[model samples]
Target chain A: MKKRGIGIGSIFYGTGYGNGFPDVSKAVAQLKSDGKIAIYVGATEVGQGAKTALSQIAAEVLGLSVDDIVFINEDTSITPDSGTAAASRQTYNTGNAIKLACEKLKRDILEVAKDYLGLNSIVGLTLKNGYVYPKTLPEKRVSLGEISESLESSLKEEAVFTAQTTEMDEETGQGAPYWPYTFSACGVEVEVDTETGRVEIIRAVLAQDVGRAINPELIEGQIDGGFAMGAGYALYEDLKIEKGKIKNNSFTNYLIPTSLDMPDIEKVIIEDPESTAPYGAKGIGEPVMIPVAPAILNAIYDAVGVRMTEIPVTPEKLLKAIKEKEMTYNEGKN
Target chain B: MKKIKLTVNKKEYMLEIKEDTRLIDLLRDVLGFTGVKEGCGEGECGACTVIMDGDIVNSCLVLAFQADGKEIITIEGVESEEEIHPIQQAFLDVGAVQCGFCTPGMILSAKALLDKNPSPTREEIRAAISGNLCRCTGYNKIVDAIERAALYLKRGK
Candidate 1:
C-alpha cells in the first residue's frame, strides 16, 4: 500500500459524471496477484456496450488486453452502487473509477520499480503489450510475472471510489448542470406517401459530439441502436398504455420500427476529448437516443406541412391532418 | 411429449418437448442457447427470428415440433470459430447493436433476405429486418450494417 495520486473531476453539467485518473502499471500488478477485482459502478451492458467499455478502461489502466477484464454488469452483488449506465455517464464516471484503482496499483508497482532498478522516476519506463520497459533499453522490460512476484511481497490496499453530483433544483429541474454533456444533431429527409400516410425516411445524416471514442466501432453501434429506437418512436413505434397498464407490453401491440422501416442513415462522429476521460473519451450511450426522437419528429414536420405534436404518427393521424388541411383550403376556396 | 430431432448450427439436438413449446423456448431454456431471445414471444417483434432451411421465421411463432428434423441456424451457427458471420461483423463494424437483445434476430432476418437476394435494394433490406424492433439505436444504423454486409458478401470477403 502506497500514497496514490488520484483525483475525481466532474467533466460536464447535467451528466452527473466524475472521473478518477489512475496509474496503469500498478493496477496490472495488483490484478496479477489479486486473482479478481470487484467493481460496484452501476453500469449495465444491456447491449449499450457498458461492459465492454468498462473492461477496456480496466484493460487500458492495467496494461492488459480487453479479454483480461471481466465486468459484472448485473448481479448488484459484485458491482459498485453507482447510478445506471444512462446519460452517457458510464464511460466517464465508471471509467474514472477503474483509472483510480489503476493509479493506486501503479503506486504500488512504482515502489517495486524503484527497489528493482533503484530509480526515482520510472519516466523511462514504457508500458506496452502487458510489459513495462525502460524506453532507452527495450530488452530491460519487466514481465508481468516479475511484477506479480513483487506484488506478492508487498502489502495490498483497497481501491474504492464513488462519482457523484448534487441534486437539481427540484422546482425548475435545473442543477449545477450536467458535469459533461455530449452534444449531437441529425438531419433527416423523408418521403410521405400521400395516399397511405406511410413515411419513409429517405436519408439521415447525424453529427455527434462524443468527448472521446473508447471504441470507434462500438460508438457507432450505440448511435445506430439509438436511431432504430427513435425511428420506431417516430412513425411505427408506440407503447400502448391504457388504464395505467401497459397495453403494448408485448411486441404485437407495441409497434417498433422493423428492418422494413429502416431509413438510409449516415453517421458523422464528432470527437472533443474531455480532459477527465481516459484518452479523453466521453460516454456516447444515452445521448444517442435522447436527441433522436426529437430529430425524427422535426423531420416529419419538414416532410409534411402538418406538425403532428404527438409521437408515433399512425397513418390515421396523418390522414386526419391531411383531411383537416384540405377542408380548410376547400372552405377558403368556397 | 414428442421427441423432436433438430439440426442447429450443424449439430443435432434431440429435444423432448410439448407440442405447444415454441422454438424460442427450446433454444433458450432447453438447449441453453440464449442468443435467440424472446422479446415479445409473438411474431409482432422479430426478437425470436431464426433461419430455417435458408428462410427466416419467428421462432416464437414456430412450434418446437414443427422444427423436428429441420435445418435451423441460430446466430451461434452463423459464425465459425475463426471469423464472425458477415452480417454480425457488418453489424459490429457499422455499429448495429445496442442493448443487443434484438441483434440476433435482426441479423438472422438480414441473412434470410441476403440468401434470397444477394443484392438487395435499400427497400428490400428495410423489408428484410422490418419485423425486429430495436429501442436503443434507430433503424438507420441497422440498415446501414445490412447494406454493408451485402457488399462484403458480394466481394466474397
Candidate 2:
C-alpha cells in the first residue's frame, strides 16, 4: 500500500558573527581616467553568487550597469576585512558597508558637479546612467567620465557597518543571538511504500522571508540548492563512524542526492524588507537549509504512522519502525 | 612503464607512463588539464568524467594504460578558439554554474547525451547527468540547461 503525507518547518535570523560583534568594511573607488567603479570587500563566493549579488548592489547604488563595476572579493591582500562568508552575513553586513561607501562617493561627485555646473544647492540633482543632472534641467548635465577627466585623480570612499546585539549573561546563558532574523518555511509531500519502507519525495514548496531579493534568480538558485542538500540530509547522507574513526568517508558509501533523487520544488520568495539591511535585503544562505529535514520527517510520520527520530531515515530504519508499530498494535488488541 | 599514444582535445601525445597511473592523473598532472576535478578520486562522484572514444567514462576509474590509442575529450576541448560550445553557453544562460567545480563533468555528460539523442525528455536529461554530482545549483538548473542546449542544438543556434 502507498500513502502520502505533508510536513512544515521554519528558520530564525542569524548573522555570521555571533551576537553580531564583528564590523564589516567596504571600499569603493572611481577610476579617474576610465570612470569605472571598483568595490573591494573580503567576502568569499562559495557558489553563493556573492560576486554577482554584491555587484548588483553596487551597480544599483552607482546608477551603472553591473558589468561596469569591478568587484575584488575574498582576496586578503587586496580587499578589506568584511568578515567571513558564513551565517549569511555578507549580504547584510558587507552590503550595507558598500551601500554607504557608494553614497559617500556619490555625494563627493555631486559636490564636484555642483561647483562645475554652478547649481545653487545640491537638491534636485540626481545621478543616472553615468550622468549627474538637475531634476528640471536634464540638458545641464555632466558625464561621470568627463568629471573624472577634469579631476585628474580617482575618487575613493570607504565605510564600515556593524550590527547591534547584546551579549549572553554568564549565569543565565541567555542573550540576543542575532540582530535581525531571516525566516523560512518548507512543506514537503512524500509517498511511503509500506512493504519496502522506501519513501519518495514528490513535491516541495518552500517559502522564505528574504527581506528583499537583490537578484531574484540567484535567490531561487539558493533555494533549490538548499533543498537538495536538505533532502540528502533527510534521506541518504550519513557518516558511519566506529570508535571515532570514519567508516564511510568516500562517496561510494556516503550518498548525496543525484538529479533523479531530487523532487519538484516550488520556491516562494517573500519580500518583508529589513530596515537594517542594504536595499532592504537580508541573508538567505544558511536559512534555506534549516527547515528541510524536519519537513521531510514530518511527512514520513504522516504517511506511515511512525515517528522517526534519527537523521537519514533510511529504508532499514523505516522498516524496523513499521514492524515495531505493528507489533505494538497487535499487543494492544490482545 | 609502457609507452601510450593518446589523442586528447585533438592533440596527439606519445608518453611513457606507469601502468597503475589513473587517467585522471595523466590528464591533470601530465597534460595540465585542471578542468577535470577530482571530488572523490573514485567513480561514484563522476567529477572526472571524460569522453573516451565516444563513450563517457570516469577518468579516475580508468587506468592510463586503458586509454592507449584512444581519442579523449576533456572540458578544455569542448570549445573552439572564438566561441564557447552550445552546451557551455546554455549552462551559463540558465545559471547552472555556481562554484563551477562540477561544470565540466556535467557539461560533458550533457554533451554525450545530446550526441546520442538530440531531443531528450526532461526525465532523460535527469537520467543522463545522474552520475555527475553538483552540490551548488541543484539539478534543476543543470537539467534546464541541458534541455535548453538540446533546443539550441536542434535549431542550430
User: Quick one: best TM-score, which candidate?
Assistant: 2
- Cα error, residue A331 of model 2, in Å, equals 1.3
DockQ of each: 0.62, 0.76
Task: Estimate, for each residue in A9-80, the C-alpha lDDT of model 2 and write its tens digit.
Answer: 876757657653655556555544677788888888998998998888888988889988888887799788
How close to the true structure is residue A61 of candidate 2, measured as C-alpha lDDT? 89
Model 1: residue B76 alpha-carbon error in angstroms: 4.6
Task: Estimate the TM-score for candidate 1.
Answer: 0.81
Best by DockQ: 2
Candidate 2 chain A lDDT trough over 10 residues, lowest sum: A23-32
TM-score of each: 0.81, 0.95
Candidate 1 residue-wise lDDT, A187-265, digit = tens: 6666777677777666666667787778877777676766777667777667667889987676556666665665555
